[model samples]
Target: MYRRIRFFLTSVLFLCVATAFCNDKENPDAIIGTWLNATGKGHIQIYKQGNKYFGKLVWLKEPNDEQGNPKVDSKNPNASLKTKPLIGATILRDFVFDDDEWNSGRIYDPQNGKDYKCFLRLKDSKTLLVRGYVGVSLLGRTETWTRIN
Candidate 1:
């Protein structure tokens, strides 16, 4: 009787530990990949840094201006950042994962020179929903991004 009871408890403990290990391994980095923007004009690469996630503009359909110079953050309100190149710019910042969604981030719109509160959700393995809003989320816009692969 003693051996049977001990074995049962040990089996339960092992199952609990295994379940936790498996859950932790289940795609915590699922969003780490390059995604094409909704307009099909640009690509953003999302990567994890520490416990936070960030995204940067990796490519653009038109990387150069009419003068053949690389595109820059020309519309930026900050004069110091005006000359910063659009490609490789960190457009998404400080996103934390919570319950399968990324929240508490900011998305920078270089075209309008504005920043908005943002959240990212993966609708499927290939589709990501990006929402950027001001004041309230209902007033903002959501864009669908497709996985590059």
Candidate 2:
């Protein structure tokens, strides 16, 4: 009886550890691939920077430029930012996953050279909803991102 009880406890413990390991492997915020902005207005590529996530403009349908060059955020009002180009500007930055959502992040709009409070939520394995807000969460726009993979 003693041996049987010991074996049963050991089996249960092993099962619990395996379950926990499996759960950790199933990360929903594994947005570590190329994604396209399905908003029809522009295209973005999301990539990882160290332990966080960021996005940059890979392509734009209606690029805001006069000479067909990629437009910078001239309307930023910040002299330093207004001169930066749009192509390689870091639009999404410091996105960390919390539970099921990414919060307290910032998104830069190259067209306006403005950074807004950004949060992202995975609608599924392929779809991500990215929101950019000013002061309040309610005052934000949600854009759907489709995984390129």
Candidate 3:
């Protein structure tokens, strides 16, 4: 009877410890890392800030223009922002985890200076599906982003 009681107590303790280690909110940075864009044109480093997530340009395929000058957002719709450099630009913003995925985020495309409603769903530990749309999520396009490291 004493052996049975010891076994039961050990099992309960094990379960409680496991449950605490497997919580989602506790791992807010589960998806924080460097990821490559679909076309292999950019590497974005996702980071967390005050319970929200954002991504910025860390590396670029072509960092310089034809004249060997650092690249700028020349295509930006806003004339004032057109001169802003591309490196370290905040291209993703305001992401929160929800329903086993990260939702309610915005992705900014520097190529066209357009912002799209986007959400991220991890396909696995090494892959992520990023969907961007205008209105409803059903009308969006999904892009596969591979984890950089």
Best by lDDT: 1
What is the Å distance of residue 112 in model 1 from its true position? 0.3
Q: What is the TM-score (0 to 1) of candidate 1?
A: 0.82
Give a tens-digit lDDT track for model 3, residues 1-149.
Answer: 99999999999999999878865434657779999999898999999999999999989999889999889988778898788889888888999988668889999999888999999888776788999999999988999999998
The digit string of per-residue lDDT tens for model 1 on 11-96 reads 99999998766552245587899999999999999999999999999999999999999999999889999999999999999998
Mark the 10 consecutive residues where model 1 has the least summed lDDT: 19-28
Q: RMSD of each candidate?
A: 5.7, 5.6, 3.7
Over the stretch 1-149, how does candidate 2's per-residue lDDT look in tens digits?
99999999999999999877655325744666667776666666777777788887776666667787767768776788776666666678998877878777998776555789999887776788889999998998998898876
Task: Provide the lowest-lDDT 10-residue window in model 2.
Answer: 21-30
lDDT score of residue 71 within candidate 1: 100
Q: Give the per-residue Cα lDDT of candidate 1 at 20.
A: 68
Q: Global lDDT of each model? A: 0.92, 0.77, 0.88
